[model samples]
Target chain A: MAQNQSAPDATRRSERSRRAIYDAALALVAEVGYPKTTIEGIASRAGVGKQTIYRWWSSKADVLLEAFLDLSGQAAEAAAQDRPSADASPYGIPDTGDLAADLKHVLRATVDELRDPAFEAPSRALAAEGVVNEELGRRFVATLLEPQLQLYVDRLRSAQEAGDVRPDLDPRIALELFVSPLAQRWLQYTGPITYEYTDTLVDYALNGLAPR
Target chain B: MAQNQSAPDATRRSERSRRAIYDAALALVAEVGYPKTTIEGIASRAGVGKQTIYRWWSSKADVLLEAFLDLSGQAAEAAAQDRPSADASPYGIPDTGDLAADLKHVLRATVDELRDPAFEAPSRALAAEGVVNEELGRRFVATLLEPQLQLYVDRLRSAQEAGDVRPDLDPRIALELFVSPLAQRWLQYTGPITYEYTDTLVDYALNGLAPR
Candidate 1:
């Protein structure tokens, strides 16, 4: 009976240690960026042995990726909880019959996510590295960016089936009309991103650039 | 009369030195990246003293910026010559009265420019630095990116007057739907760029995402 009780305590302790490691990894990456982040640095900051980090993840990139994934999931969950009406899908965008409204809703949430302090620094570090590092750039986009973009593709497909979007339009390219503008504004500091900017993008994209 | 001939020779030598400095600055940035590039290194590569660089430009940033502008001007001139048509304007996009075709033509040129090996490496170095360096990023966007983007804005304004685009749309933001998509694809390695891809972006931006 005592061993059984001790097992649960040990599990709790392990979980706590894992969280601390993730937090350290994220903070280190943000503070010093990707190239400077090391396993020893994360281990020291987390107050765990270097062996402890290695036991869980193979490399600094792995730790950082998982930490970011966790951070994004938490932010999404928090946003979803704050607004009960929000379409909270872990795997995809909400398929509300109104495609424009659904897209705008998701993009607005994305604005919040971009503004979130927890997500900003680490993401910027990764993004900056990806700018010059071709291998990392491809992997990061494949694993992180493409998945999110695919959600838009799926949503557009649904829009096509519903007759809201033109069947002839390639959803991949069509999604960029609304998506890439906000992304460029955020990445390049080209302009301010607000609900107003995103909303305008939707309207312009839905209606067309030319006179209707 | 001898002194007058010497004056012409001196002017030609100065022009050669200036071109050599610009070439060195771009080549160093591409080789070592932005952070590692220094005025001293540029000077050494140019076969001039560091003081010579300081005499002409205040900082490495200034040198790199001017170098890039000169490079882009050469590329544009080359592209213009390659075309069988009349002279292309240095200041604005072609406004051939056919808005879609003109936009597609310009964007295709941009696709070629981005893909050019001579432009790619140095550009990536500066762009990577821009991701983390806000002041430099803003400066680059203002001087280099914004000015080029404005040419599109001018073209779109003309389109609006011609009833090709809706007057209600913000051309600045409307332009991004097509422009930013290409930029993002190049900067992030998110997708492949081709004449076909840019052509599709033009169509989507000109038309609505919804059924016409």
Candidate 2:
């Protein structure tokens, strides 16, 4: 009975330490950027030993990737909770039989998230590093970004089956029409991101910029 | 005779120093990135006095911006010389009556420019800095990027006037359908950039993704 009680207490302690490490990693990355962000700094900030960080994650990159993944998962969950549907998957786009509406809805949520202070600073720092560091960029894309992009691919494939999108359209490339515009605006400050802007992107992408 | 002889020599020396400075600035930015690149470094690398750089350009940002502008101008001039027309503006897109063909041709050339090692490294460094620094990003966009995007707006406007594009579409936003995809791929390594990829983007952007 004492061993069982000790197991639960130890599990709770580990979970608390994990959360603290994630917070520290994110804060350090945001403050100092990717290059200056170190495993030692994260450990010091989290009030844990350097060995504690190594025990859980091998590198600063690994710590950051997991922290970001956790943060994004929480954001998706929060967004899901805000919706009317009880069955919405946190990472999935709504397939409400209207491809344009669904895309616009998800994109609008993205606009809000991009503006959020919690998400913006660290994401910009990591993304800025990725632009110059090809190895890290590929890893970030493969692990974090690609999974999110695949969600759109899945949605587009379903749209193809439902006759909402062109059957011959490569879902991967087709999704870039609306998605890439918003990304460029956020990443490059090329333009403002608003619901109206995203809505226009959907309309132009679906109807074509050329006369239909 | 003495003054006339020295005038041409002085002009030639000034021109050589300017080119050397530009080359040095670009190389330093490419090697060490923006934040670490300094006037002293550029001066030392160019074999010129710090005062010489200050005599012409106000800051390192100014020096780098002008260097990039000069490099881009030379590249644009080379591209213009390759074209069939003697009248093509280096900064302007070709306005063949067939809009799709013209846009594809230019984007293909852009793909070539993007792959150039001399262009890629310095551009990536500057762009990465711009991602994190909004002030510099805005200035970079205004000076270097927006002017290029304006060329697209001009072409699209012409397409609209000729009844090739929808009369109601905003040209600025409309151009992003194709342009932003290429930008995102190049900036993020999200996908492979090829003539085929850019060509397909043009087709999808011009034609609706929905079944006609």
Which candidate has the highest TM-score of all? 2
Off by over 4 Å in 1: A85-91, B84-88
Return the lDDT, model 1, position A103: 89
Deviation in angstroms for A16 in model 2?
1.3
Individual DockQ of the candidates? 0.85, 0.86
Q: Look at candidate 1 and tell me the lDDT of residue B164.
A: 95
TM-score of 1: 0.95
Q: Write the per-residue lDDT of candidate 1 for residues A1-212, one digit (tens) a residue.
A: 99989999999999999899989998998898788899999999999999988888999888877887788778767866766465547546788698888889889988988888888888888888888888888877887788889889999998999999999999988999988998888788999989989999999999999987
By DockQ, who's the top model here?
2
TM-score of chain B taken alone, candidate 2: 0.98
Candidate 2's docking class is high
Candidate 2's displacement at residue B9, Å, is 1.8
Q: Which stretches of candidate 2 lie over 4 Å from their true place?
A: A86-88
Model 2 over residues A57-151: C-alpha lDDT tens digits?
A: 99999999999999998999899988868434767988888889889999999999999999999999999999999988888888888888899
Candidate 1 at residue A139, lDDT?
78
Q: What is the DockQ of candidate 2?
A: 0.86
